[model samples]
Target: MRMNFGHLRGVHVRVFVPSSPYFPAYAQGQGPPPMVQERFQSVISQLFQYRIIRCGGAVDDDMANIIVAQLLYLDAVDPNKDIVMYVNSPGGSVTAGMAIFDTMRHIRPDVSTVCVGLAASMGAFLLSAGTKGKRYSLPNSRIMIHQPLGGAQGGQTDIDIQANEMLHHKANLNGYLSYHTGQSLEKINQDTDRDFFMSAKEAKEYGLIDGVIMNPLKALQPLAAAAEGKDQGSV
Candidate 1:
């Protein structure tokens, strides 16, 4: 069935159920039934209505493109509303990560990032790049930062060229970390020379995140109350 998620920029979310006679039955516990699949899609649609975006797995071109599109579309829908991005990535492709980081800053709506698992390398950079005073992490989440990794394989001249490009990108990334985390460029360089890992509390201390979310329930109360007030005021 085609479900029109009108609130999510009119995207049509399709839930395809296998009609083949060979399809396993739910009674045999082989897979979820069609109704369950539809419910899963509905849950995702509800999350979009609240402007929640998930950046999970690796930071790559496809992931970055989808996130940037969502951010821009949501901002167009309501610039005043905040966009909450949940990040749980191992980090990949500095160029792709930069695209996402830049779009987060370029959009009109504030982007609040929450780290739920591991935010390493470029993932850490993006988490730290969230709107000031809005970056957060769960108590057990981990964040890591390090110098960009380069894989240059070619003739000597080509390798040299790639090395130079990598160095340039490294400098740019360090500068951004310094700016966002209020750390000196020298400090950032020193720390990132080796893999630097931080728990949520340590990340907050290092200025990578504004706060560690200790109590999920209490943490959501303020947001829920604010939303409630807005709804009543609108009526």
Candidate 2:
């Protein structure tokens, strides 16, 4: 659940962590969409249980810098303990994502990601940034990919020029995804031409994630009924 903070005067856009049990301010983040607030929140809860620190959302710096700082701090505090990152982001600048992604790849800590809602654009790239033993969303959750699009205001010639830039951008994005996913560069380029969104099941099949995690709370009632049936059979 979220509210319109637009009414506030002279407001500075800051990412906020929603209070636990009811993540209200979560969807109102700086780096990504707020829809998967619940899923990201769940990952945070899980990480805290293991004593990993949470960080980020520092004003105009794209937030990745803040995230990196936090991870480094955690490593210093406890060199032996592994860290988990719960990322729910639509992605920001390429430079920012690359920095954060590199931090995850090179950091000595154990970094795992749970793509709760949607990891679109550079956000999906960050998911691919996880070191190893990564997890993903339930089958219904979305994962998307594509090149960054710049806003344009120009004529046909300018449009053609932008198209060329788009092609180059696609090449760069494919280079990274192909290197990580091991898919053909041609396939990655083709897929990013248009927005490609995959369900968790599809992501697993493509080797994007280790597996899909069904919402256990949503399945509780059915499991309870199955348990009751077994008990009645014994009776």
Say which candidate scores most in lDDT. Answer: 1
Clashing residue pairs in candidate 1 are: none
Give the TM-scores of the predictions, in the order they appear.
Answer: 0.79, 0.62
Off by over 4 Å in 2: 1-60, 152-169, 215-235
Error of 1 at 31 (Å): 6.0
The sequence of per-residue lDDT tens digits that candidate 1 reaches over residues 14-123 is 54432321122343555677888678668766777888887876677777788888899999999988888888877877888888998998999888888888888888
C-alpha positional error of residue 129 in candidate 2 after TM-score superposition, expressed in Å = 1.6
TM-score of candidate 2 against the unseen true structure:
0.62
Residue pairs clashing, model 2 = 27-34
Q: Judged by lDDT against the true structure, how good is candidate 1? A: 0.75
lDDT of 2 by residue, 76-123 (tens): 777655565544555546656666777776667666555656666776
